[model samples]
Every structure is written in structure tokens, then in C-alpha cells.
Target: MSQAPVVGVAVFVVKGDKVLLGRRRSSVGHNTYALPGGHLEFGESFEECAAREVKEETGLDIKDIQFITVTNNVFTEAAKQLHVVAVIMRASLVDPEQLPQNVEPEKCDGWDWYDWKNLPQPLFQPLETMLKNGFSPFPAKLN
Candidate 1:
């Protein structure tokens, strides 16, 4: 049997009308636009991993990770079997004034704030689906 692919976490962090985005560096899909988060290191909780990834990639501290959707991605076109379990989280910014420097500049080409209603195509695809149709696997309690 083929090995199971790696699991990762993604956060759709929002502030006002903008969402945080990370321009992919040299990973699975280099130079692609993606959420500002990544995989969970061994021995780390999903929430902790989410926070650490956001801080490391986008120079932002995130807190209070709420449950979102999960994506099971299988890359069959790469000639190599790679599966990814992405746990999408809804988190908030801990501080807006103190954006840190990108720890891995090579992995993140740039960061930008785009309007939610009209996001660039680079930030489209699955993210657009997430925005339009949120998680429905479980009941969500409204405030």
C-alpha cells in the first residue's frame, strides 16, 4: 500500500474586509496564493501548529482557533502519490500593530490584504468555496 500523505492546517484569518494570504515559496505549489498556515510538527496540537505557522509565515500572531472545514487532497497528477489532510481553522489576530518579519522569506514571496468580496484569482479556488460555503459537517452555534 502507498504511504499516507502528510497532514496540514490552514487558517482563514480575517480582519475587517481583508483576509491574510501567503504567496507560496518553494513547496508543493510554488508561487501560489494560499492561507497563512502550514503543517503540524510532531508532538504539537493543531491549534498550536496553526498559531506557529501564521506567525512564522505572515508575521502575525493568531489566537482562539475555532473549528472549520477539513480538506483531503490527493495529488495524482504529480507522478507521485501525495495526500494532504488540511484542517481549516478560523482564528483572530492577537495584535494588528506589530507585524513581524517573515521568518522564511524564501518560502513566502509576499503578503497582501485583499477584499473578501472580490479576492484575486490567486486567492480563489478552494478558498472561494470556503468563503461561500462554510463547514457543514457539524452544527455551528451562532452568536
Candidate 2:
């Protein structure tokens, strides 16, 4: 029997025309760009997980966290099958002036702002699922 798919929360922080992203260095999506998120901790809501993950990985507090979409992602890499249930959310920085930094240098290369239309290549699977399903994080004002 295989293990159950892990549940993860992906927080999309939009500022103007760009969204916050980080290049992953860990196994699941190593060398691929992804939103700042991780496994859902026990007793934490999806919004709570999004906020906590953003703060933990990006060194910024996120506000207005709202549910966006969910994706069931299944993929195989190097003959190892993996699956994940991804909870996607949108948020903004509590302080606009606060910049994001790499809080987990061992797991991530760094954080950067990328235009939605020009996202970096080799995106993490969950994120690619969102994009393929027409998920957009840009605020109405910017869209």
C-alpha cells in the first residue's frame, strides 16, 4: 500500500503586477519555482497554514489570506510516484514595505517577484496545475 497524499497550502502574495515565488531546493520539486508553502500542520486551518508558511519561508507577514482553489496533483519523478492535495490561497503583505527574504536557505534558493504572464520555467507541479486550470492570483484592480 502507498502512503496517502500530503496536503499542502500554497500562498500567493500579489503586489502590483508580480507574485512572490521561490526556487525550491528540496526533493519534491528541486530546482523548480513555487509559491511559499508547505505541509498543513495539525490543528491549523488552510488560511493559518498559508500565513504561517509565508512568514516562515519568506520572512514576511501575510494578510487577507483567502481561499482561491484546490488541486489534486499526481506525478512521477525518477520512478518514484508522488501525489499531493494542494490548497491554494491569495494574500498580501501586512506591511507593503516589508520585503521577502530567504528564511530557509537549505530548502530554497531565494525569493523573487515574478510576473504572472512570465513565470519562471519548470514550475512545481501543484502550481502548474493551478495555472493550467486558469487560476489567477492578480487582484481585480491589476487584472
Candidate 3:
């Protein structure tokens, strides 16, 4: 039997002109850069999921969470197919002075802020999809 597609929440925490990203360490997207987020929990709103995932993975508090866009991602690894519906969100860090740390060493290495125009290479599949679709979290550019 096949499993249903999982819904994931990808949060872009903006601080000044940069967005926070984590270098993944897990098998799913190992060695790829991705936003701080994870699978959505039952009965949880997108904002709640974003905040929770950010804090849990990056140790940062985020607020003003808002919907950005969604990407339908279907990919395969090790001959195993996987499908994920990625719900993208954008927000600002609640405390600008607080730096991001690697809270989940098993899944992520550490977090860093990067400019949108010059993002790091080898981004996670879903994030790459969003960029290809011209999805920008910045208010000045939506496409």
C-alpha cells in the first residue's frame, strides 16, 4: 500500500534583507539548504506550525507569519518515490538580537541568514520549486 502525500510547512524568517536557512543533515534532503520548517501537525494552523517548527529547528521566535505560496513536489530517492505538498510561509523574527542555533543536530547542522538574490547552492527540492515558480517572500515582489 502507498502512503498519502505529506503536508510540509516551510517558513522563511526574514531579518532585515536576509532569510534564515538550515543545512539539512537527514536522508530526505541531506546536504541541501532549506528553510526552517517541518511536517504540519494535526489541527495546527499554518502560522502555528511555522512558529513551532522555527523554534524547534532553529531556536528562534518568529511572528507576523503569513502565507506565501504552495508548491507541489514529487520526487524519488533510492528508487522510492515521494510526494509532498509544501505550504510556504513568511515571517519576521520576534527578537532580532537572538541568533539562530542548531536545535536539531540530527536533522540540521545550523542556521544562517542569506540574501534572496544570492541564495546558497543546492537548495531543497521544494524550495527550488518555489523559486522556479517565481515565489518570493519579500513584499515588493510576489512573482
Candidate 4:
């Protein structure tokens, strides 16, 4: 059997120099810090996927969902391999005072904003791929 790359939507919810991340509890990258997102559903726009997944996982409403970049990531497990075309995005909270909660504790530990330049250790693979390529949502224009 053959498999195709699935679309994985990830959102960077930016506030000042900080972005939100959660410690994943899922199998794909268990225990690694990752952004709020999930697989895109059929017929759903990238923006819609971004908004829905963030809200579903973190209980956070976001706006200004903008296309950031895409990374082709391939993961391998014993006798299995998965490929994903990760559609990365950037957004802001609908309300600046809105706090993130662990809406889906089964999937993630919790969500909290962290400095982009000083991210948490053991980042999820796809995110690590992005950083290795010099991707920074926050340019000097942000500060």
C-alpha cells in the first residue's frame, strides 16, 4: 500500500516577543513542546483548521491567521513511516487577556506563552525542522 502526505496545520499564536506552546502528550511527538494545531479536515481552509484546532486543544480564540511557511516532514517508526506537509501559520489572540487552558489534557499537558528566542527544550520534530532553516515569526520589527 502507498500513502500520501497529509496536511498538518500548526499555528503560532504570537503576543509581543512570545508565542504559545504546549507539551505534547500524543504519540507522534510525546513529551516534546509544540504549537497548537492538528491535521486539517477535508474541505477546511488552512485558516479554519488553524482556528479550530487551537480552540479545541487550548481553548484560545485567535485572529489574523496568516500563512507563515510550509515544511515537508517525514517520520519513521518501527515498520511504519508517516509524511506530513505541515502548513504553519501565525495568529494573535482574539482577546489579549484570554488565557490558554488545557482543553484537551489527553493530548497535551497545557499551553503557555514563551519567548521565541528562548524556547523550551526538546521541541517537536516539525518545529525543530523549521528553526534549523532559520524561521523566526518574530523579526526585529516585532519588538
Residues 65-126 of candidate 4: C-alpha lDDT, one tens digit per residue: 99988889888852567898999999999999999999999999989999988999899998
TM-score of each: 0.79, 0.91, 0.92, 0.93
* Candidate 2 wrongly placed segments (more than 4 Å): 78-80, 139-143
Model 2 / residue 64 / CA error / Å? 0.4
Least accurate 10 contiguous residues by lDDT in model 1: 131-140
lDDT of 1 by residue, 73-130 (tens): 7756455666888888877788866554667788887777667666666542456556
Task: Give the alpha-carbon lDDT of every model.
Answer: 0.71, 0.88, 0.88, 0.91
Q: Tens-digit lDDT track for model 3 on 58-85?
A: 8899999999888888777835677889
Candidate 4 TM-score to native:
0.93
> 48-95 in candidate 2: lDDT tens per residue?
999899999999998999998788877677357778888989998899
Q: In terms of TM-score, how similar is model 2 to the real structure?
A: 0.91
How many collisions per candidate?
Answer: 0, 0, 0, 0
Error of 3 at 36 (Å): 0.7
Best by TM-score: 4
